[model samples]
Target chain A: MKNLNRRDFLKTAALGAAAATLGTKSAKASEKLLSEDRLGVLVDTSVCVGCRHCEWACRLAHNMPSPALDYYSNPTVLKEFRRPDKTALTVVNEFENDKNPNLPIHVKIQCMHCDHPACVSACIVGALTKNEDGSVVWDDGKCIGCRYCMVACQFQIPTYDYDVSIDPHIRKCDFCTERRKEGQLPACVNICPNEALVFGKRSEILRIAKNRTKRKPDIYINHIYGESEIGGTSWVYIAGKDFNELKMPPLGKNPAPGISEAIQHGIFAYFVPPVTLYALLGTIMWVTKRRNESADKDKHDHHSDSHDHHSDSGRDPYRTSGHNTYRDSGHNTYRDSGLSTDKDTKGDNL
Target chain B: MKPAPVKHRFFTPGVIILAVLALNGLIFLAVRFISGLGAVTNLDNNTPWGLWIGVDVAAGVALAAGGFTSAALGHVIHREHYHAIVRPALLTALLGYTFVAFAVCVDIGRFYYIWHPLIMWNGNSALFEVGICVMIYMTVLYIEFLPIVTEKFMGKVNLPGFLETFNEPADKLLRMLNSGLSKTMFIFIIAGVVLSTLHQSSLGTLMVIAGQKMHPLWQTPVLPLLFLLSAIAVGFPMIIFESLIASRSFKMKPEMKILSRLGSMVAPILGVYLAVKIGDMFISDDFKYILKFDVPAWMFMAETGLIIIAFVLFLSKETTRSPGRLFLASSLVIAGVLLNRINNFIVAYKPLYDPVAYFPSFGEISVTVGCIALLVLIYRAVVIYFPVISHK
Candidate 1:
């Protein structure tokens, strides 16, 4: 017993060392893959006027259908606050303060384009893709239209056209990928007359956001929204009020996608579970087969014992006399019916 | 009478209702394509996703987890005690995923581009894995049900001359096929188990991106654990309920002896889930929210209450043994999972500076209902045609 215990302990120790070594190697590889040069956007809420140019530009740029409600006709629309839909990629909403009685603040709502996007992580079909250039995009061809991305997104930026006859796709802001490729700004950024939105590299935007805070400490909130929220977003904001006051959700510094992925990847990192499960199943089937064999043997032994008893009665159990044959035929009838397990037993022969 | 082996096939009540729903659903889908998502859905810029997503697809996948969990514990673990309950669990999971696929078809804006993910490889996105897994998993589920098809159609049947050529000594052929299929069953089962685990947990991770928008009661690093555990907790109970209904309806022997045993095993997992949930809240100081009587706080209480009720119902051997009680308990467990998902994704989630709220349009609700109705129709068809029940 002692020897067996020592051998098992040594075996476990060796396996542990191997597992640790493999784990470190994978971690090192992952570290190398993590991108450092993240891109982002800067929004200064202090200098903003409520103009719906972003909405118009977004629709036109994407070739999406025009909205039924005229942008100019609905002056209070901003006051009502709008959300980005399948058609409308971005919207500007007004927030008024009853106490201060200042001009209502305008906040633009669009896809935040997170540094590590949850939609990207939630997409199983690779429909939602994150580009190396820091823009999170979508590919409809691969999408089975399971809107998991919409459910998983913290910003809830992606919208689906549920009314489409056959194949509806997820619609949202894509950081104006085409325009960015042509060295142009996103439609929203290009159309913003007040310069409320600033488009640049994430590092540059972070610098600009910080400089604004340093220049006028009292005018803007110190923190930048999306800087570290959900592991950061391309669209960062400096708001007039606390983030929660704006109804901004509280998020952790780490990517929400990462937390869930860690557990998912950990348990099923490779084929550990599948292999283990098979080995266990095979063992059970093997055991059940053995039990069946033993049950068969027990029945065979009982039949032989019963045959000895019939022969000892001197009844000529194996004879072919007419009376004997008649009884033999009767006994064989029951045996042929699959109702008798004991092939050699006779109740009256003894 | 053997019920003519097949039921009357032309325009059955179930089929008629599905046909009507399909017509309406197709029309709504048309409007969505022509006018874009804004035309039909109650979704907005602030609330980007709606019921088409949170309820139909994401929650649907979570519910379908019954198949993998039951298969793992029953077959892989060599628990003959659980064998009686496995088939029904797989059936529920199979139907759930079929519904998910239907929901997905109705949920996206540009439906034509749905195949892009399979053609492309975007490993970075969690959505990528979710989509691929769901697609592959659905196919796997259908394959898993093939034996039922074989047992019903091929077993104890006379083949025509042409057909008989393929199945000389058909019994031997079937036995061979069964054995061959069994030998490699582990591969499919393993893939199914792994994929289910990935996507169910990914469902929780999907919400982590929302950050501050989500209520504190739900937001945590332990979301994956919570989702997977909840899925497993609901799995056995789902199987039990299905078995009870099928047996009672079909006038067959109730597999209560085995089902109750499985329920006993599942009860502790529920207890562990609740403990971990509370423990996380306490450790993170997020438990403070539970003290408040606000919507978020009340929702948390209600969610936990339902789960605890399910746990209590299952824990007692007497209640677990009773079919009615077992069914009710499992239903509650499933309800608890749905409510938790809705709370995390919709009810408790609030976007910044967006006063606009969402309520699905009549058309949106209709489409979702249609998808669910289709699942029922398919389930009915499969059950009637396949020998899902054991032949004693």
Candidate 2:
């Protein structure tokens, strides 16, 4: 019965291991996902005219409620800074351009579509995918509305509809994956009246951003925002003001999920650590049990020996005289124990 | 002596108050379901998770570490003396994880799709690890609690309907199950400890991907280590806390001898945790961030201070020997760990464009408090109905 049980256990364990291996593959960010010829967007905030047309166009493309085209012309809403929320996938916030006081810089904010997107790495269900074309898109069918992606996003881009309890989507900019497939630019990029928003190959736009900054040094900042931030985002930006002044989150060059994933993989590395700890703990338990039982038996033996000595002294003192040497050894132990001089006398009498 | 059900009347003034709190929470919960989370919570687009995920889920999971810690000590280490306290701790973990799963369902926007994590796979996500571990551990806990059920109703099963014909069969089935479980119980006992360790640490990893948005005072690569250590440290105290409360309510003498010994071990564990925590702060040079004395800084100070104070209280012989002082110390540790989870999830998350700071609304507070009160009431009911707490 025990042999059969052991075989069954091993069989079950092997099957479990197989299921676990086939169960969860690492997200797309597991390997280097930078496909050659990947697209990117370059935003020149210096050339933006604060039209807010991109905001209107973004809402229209994503099937969100959009007001009339003239409604976005209202500069009153631009007074206070805004972020992309459930109501809008992207919003252009107007920041004061110190270089030119008259014309405020209208910077369009959306998902950066990072090459190493944290949301894609962080989504519990693999609901968010990082496409090879350099767009991070959320699958509505896969999202469980955990909102972990929102927390993981460094850009604070993804938004949720808290008002709608059921089937609420994780709203985020998908970089117009649909339009790009149709050979059209993103709605925001298409409607940009000032060619301020340029969409092309990531490498080409990166070179273009650097050249533009180099050609007009006074008009743009030396650093191309998102060029290398958080391992190079697909959305690069050039503004006269600092990126912080543009309200972009300060991030290190390393990817956001680097440390977390390393620790995760290290803990479950081939399931060796957990299984080793399990075996080690099982051995300890087994050893402790054996030691405890043996200790109890030793105590029982000592009690039984004392009873035998009592019986020999009380009833048949001369019967076990051949065991005197053993008694003498016991006397030595009694002396060393120092539990009591009474036991020592009893040993000497023996 | 074998554990037996505590014989007591169900209703009391405290229980009445708890019932009222549960009722009040249910009303708000109904509103939450009907109108939406926006009606009940302060959560919006800027802050997706709030009190439910922080206090109800994270803190709940952390405090439930007593189940694994006691299991490790009693069963894995074969410390026969600790066997008396193990059952109660298991019950708490079982209930705690159940509520945690329930809270996740309630908190998620698509409540019906809470099972997506089971089929969907994301190996890199910390939440996925936590979710899977928690689900498996809860199952292990339920299986662990089955012996108590068998002990309670093995021969006493009396079906009240036409199903009464199957009473003997039910009893026989339970006997078979009891034998099977006894033969193979070690697998679940070890698995419970392993699953607990994995999830407790992964809960800390949940906040790591937040990067710079999380306050450096609470954010570190060693956060998972700190979380696991802190959870292990608090385990005995949580057992002590609930054990004392159970003893008081049942009008039984507190097991001071075993409890004091348990309390004695807490200091060393807590010392290790505090050393690692402060050492990490120094290693990262985030100690300066604390000196800035902002809200996050103050929250951080309060969290560590409570732990330091609890650690000191635990070291004193008098505190452990006396039930009141031990209770106070345990409460301190519980509050400290609870605050740590909150500080990490809520206070530490600072987005770039947040217009206002996030705080739990009245409705959210009502539901959280209500759920806890309800949990305690259920705990009381279980102890009364089952053979859990042992009498010496």
What lDDT does model 1 reach? 0.67
Model 1 per-residue lDDT tens digits across residues A70-161: 65447777666466776688877777643355776678888898766777766766666777667888875566665667657877678766
TM-score to native of every candidate shown: 0.74, 0.89
Q: Candidate 1 lDDT, tens digit per residue, B1-392?
A: 01112232434665787878867877886777677676878775466667777778877887777798877765555443344455666777888998887676656644566667777765545556667778898888877766655555455757877797556577667766666666676667666886787678666656655656667778775676688788877777767766776666556667777677777877898999898788777656786788888887888888899999998888888887788888888888888887787777777666654666666788787777777667766666666665454423
DockQ of each: 0.21, 0.30
Worst 10 residues of 1 chain B by lDDT: B1-10
lDDT of 2 by residue, A54-113 (tens): 888898888888889998888899998888887888888888889878988888889999
Model 2: residue B256 alpha-carbon error in angstroms: 0.6
Candidate 1: which stretches are off by over 4 Å?
A: A1-80, A85-113, A127-134, A137-147, A156-205, A224-252, A270-350, B1-66, B81-84, B110-115, B155-176, B189-195, B294-299, B337-348, B351-381
